[model samples]
Target: MAFVAMGVYGTLSAPVRPLTHGWTLFFFVFNTAPIIPMLGVFAALYATAATRAEREMEKEYQRAENLLLNILPEPIAARLKDDPHLIADEHPSVSVLFADIVNFTETSGRLTPPEIVQTLNAAFSRFDTLVEKHGCEKIKTIGDAYMVVAGLPEPREDHAQAMVSLALDMIDAAQEINESGQFPFSMRIGISSGPVVAGVIGERKFAYDLWGDTVNVASRMESHGRPGIVQITEATRGHLGDEVQIDPLGDVEIKGKGRMRTYTVSRGFAP
Candidate 1:
């Protein structure tokens, strides 16, 4: 219609007077055309702002995610996003290590709850750093006990040794804590290597967990073993080398598992 109207006006006004040629042609055909480019500019500006906003939101999400990563396993974190109510499947070839402050019950029982948390936090801070450094996923913490593992959400050949190294560092940390005379308590670490299943256990919060004989054995090693010590099963020993010196603990009879071969790792780096 604009074109038709321009044409009609051009023809009629041209004959009306000879003065309607240059500016008349320009105005008639493009009366509203100048606004198009301005609208295009506005759209571009809007799109750029939207993109920037999206990027900012992504960064914030990642920040919170990294904080969560410090606590929960990556696989469990992913599951929490998709199906926060779903269970995580078990992954084989996983190694679980259980480490705890010895006599923590007695120690914490003597202090206030806040003091217990503070002392535990001081100990756990070092443990958590070592866990992340060794690429192991922290399973959970029960009072003074810190559970950890390797080769889940991914796998590695030396998970057993990896956990062993972390356990060594944990023992050193306990000695430091003792020197400080905070509690003068020792810590025990037990590690077992084998297949296990892991997943979220409940709905309120995402809890990354493990199950199977591997988990149970790891706990047993912790319980039956001595303080300031790292114990491993024969299977774990098979996967490790002399970098970790071993003591001939021989086969020890554990509840329900009958007699099982076990060893005490006496020498190892903070590796």
Candidate 2:
């Protein structure tokens, strides 16, 4: 429109009034015709780029949220997002389970590093599934040792029972892995139920872990446990009803706790 107006103005303002030349009108029409379409093209490009960026950013946020959930409980992870300070809480009762792959050193000697990791991953991944199935929280794995807990972050009346079931399932999973004939391994599992102080520690490398005498005793139970057996503290045993079978392992001199009784549990309730 501006170009047309300019051409009309130039024609009318001439020393002698004359009709606008064909070339002048054609020039104005040709230039003005593309203006709206060019603007639309640029607008479309900007919109597409913005939308793509937004989707990418959203995807990144989802990935981060999943990673956080993997590391900590949902409630705890939400709290950290709000304020990542010291996160410590005392639970009156929570059952802790620790399972270490037996004779890992020898297994490593026989296989390459990648092979060792694959073998460990296969076992731990199965344990992870069982942990979720039993409604337990996996604490962390220390080399071949896999740790988990129940009745924490969210408490339940059946925390001990859940841990027991998880341990039994884990033992079964390990047996299956070994039965595969490729990666032969046995698991020694320990469980204890009592008061514990749980919290998130470290800055860049954050870890949600448990402390207190209960944690120590659970570790002792695992270290002293027999291979291919689910060794559990009396505290845990006390919580188990008639739902499971147990054999007395008698008393052992725990490092810090002096003498303590332990037991081995079956996969299911006694007939």
Candidate 3:
């Protein structure tokens, strides 16, 4: 733009007619005449560039939103885009699950770090597949523990059954992993059914997460569970009914959760 302005100034200031009385200058008003047009052209070019950039940004934002919807539910993703609020959703009738590698610390000690990670990923990958198949949503992973939900973002009439089925599938998947290879990692899963607030956090690159009494109770169930078992709270047991056999685990003290009656789910869901 500066170069063009200089060129215009040079041409416009040149005199239209030779100077009178032997004045040396030939170029005059014409040299300065083109400067305004040069500036106008530069301004037009800048505006065009800015518009194109804005269009690109909008496209990128849309793509990100589409991916977010794929990972999360539609309503949640929309809330993330349309509103500036923390995207927490509370579902009073959903089932939550938590799973961890059985004796992860001891099992990890036997394998190299890479091997340990590979084993965990393989197991969690299978758990993810099962969760998806059973119409469940993956909450997140805290190291060796995997958390999942059913009928949270979107409602499902048989969320408890679906959750139990997912837990059974995870057990079967773990058995397959144990038999297929030398890795000796088994799995334990815990579940709870109640209300929780689920949402995404932060302005840039947010994560879909959940909270509430139910979430905390579910975590406690996992932390105080037996290996290769699916321990559940009374709340979830009530939802499950007699669909799956339950072995009463009696009332157990849970840190920050008080004394809660717990039970175990044995056998797979019958057809």
Candidate 4:
């Protein structure tokens, strides 16, 4: 319409005036028409790139969140996110369970490094599932040893029972793995229920761990325990009901702590 109007005006005024207005309008459109589409193309490209970048950033954030959750408990992770300060808590009653593969060092000697890792990974991964099933928190695995706790981060009345159930399930899982003939191994597990000071340590590689006498006792229970059996402290035994069957292992000498009565769960109670 502008071009038509300009053409008419130019024709009508050609005898009296110059056609400067028409030429100016034509030159203006000619100079800017290509640039208009170029600007739209540039804007679309920028928007697409921004959306892609945003999605990539979101995916990376989710991956980091999953990694954090895998390392720390859900509650602890949330707290750490809210406050960067040190995270520590005292739990008067909680059950700690530690399990070590029997004769793992000897077994590893026969197998290659990759085989050792594969076997441990397969076994611990199964135990991880059982921990979740029993509503327990798996602390960290040190080589062939697996450590877990119950009634922490969120307290529950039956912490000992949960640990017992988890131990039984883990034993069964190990047996199944052995039966498969893929990785044959036995596990010695120990449980201790008492007060423990739990906290997050380390800045670069964060670790959530437990301390106090209870932790030490739990470790001793596993170290001194018989292969393919679950040994527990008297404190932990007190928490169990009659429905679960337990056998007296008599009094055992635990390092750091004098003689303490320990028992083993022989049978009964299936996970």
Candidate that scores best on TM-score: 4
Q: Model 4, 142: alpha-carbon shift in Å?
A: 1.2
lDDT of 1: 0.83
lDDT per residue (tens digit) for residues 1-271 in model 3 = 9999999997889767855853434344457668899999999999999999999999999898788875777777767668668666667789898888878887688789888888777788878788889988987888998989999788987998999999988988888888986788678788999888887876776788888888888888888888789899999988876668888888879877789999998874534
How well does model 2 score by local distance difference test? 0.90
Ranking by TM-score: 4, 2, 1, 3
lDDT of 1 at 50: 100
Q: Candidate 1 vs candidate 4: which has greater TM-score? A: 4
- Worst 10-residue lDDT window, candidate 3: 21-30
lDDT of candidate 1 over 27-132, digit per residue (tens)? 8668778788889999999999999999999999999999877667766677678865767576778789998778878667789988888888888888889888
Q: Estimate each model's TM-score.
A: 0.74, 0.88, 0.72, 0.89
How good is model 3 by TM-score? 0.72
RMSD of each: 5.8, 3.9, 7.0, 5.9
State the TM-score for model 1. Answer: 0.74
Give one digit per residue, the lDDT tens place, for model 2 in 1-271: 9999999997678556444698769988899999999999999999999999999999999999999899999999999889989999999999998899888887789898888888888888888889998889999999989999999999898999999898888888888888989887789999999999999999998989999888888888999999899999899999999889988999978986799999999966666
Order of candidate numbers by lDDT, starting with the best: 4, 2, 3, 1
Task: Give the lDDT of residue 103 in candidate 4.
Answer: 89
Which portions of model 3 show Cα errors greater than 4 Å?
A: 1-71, 268-271
User: All candidates' lDDT scores?
Assistant: 0.83, 0.90, 0.83, 0.91
| Candidate achieving higher lDDT, 2 or 4 | 4
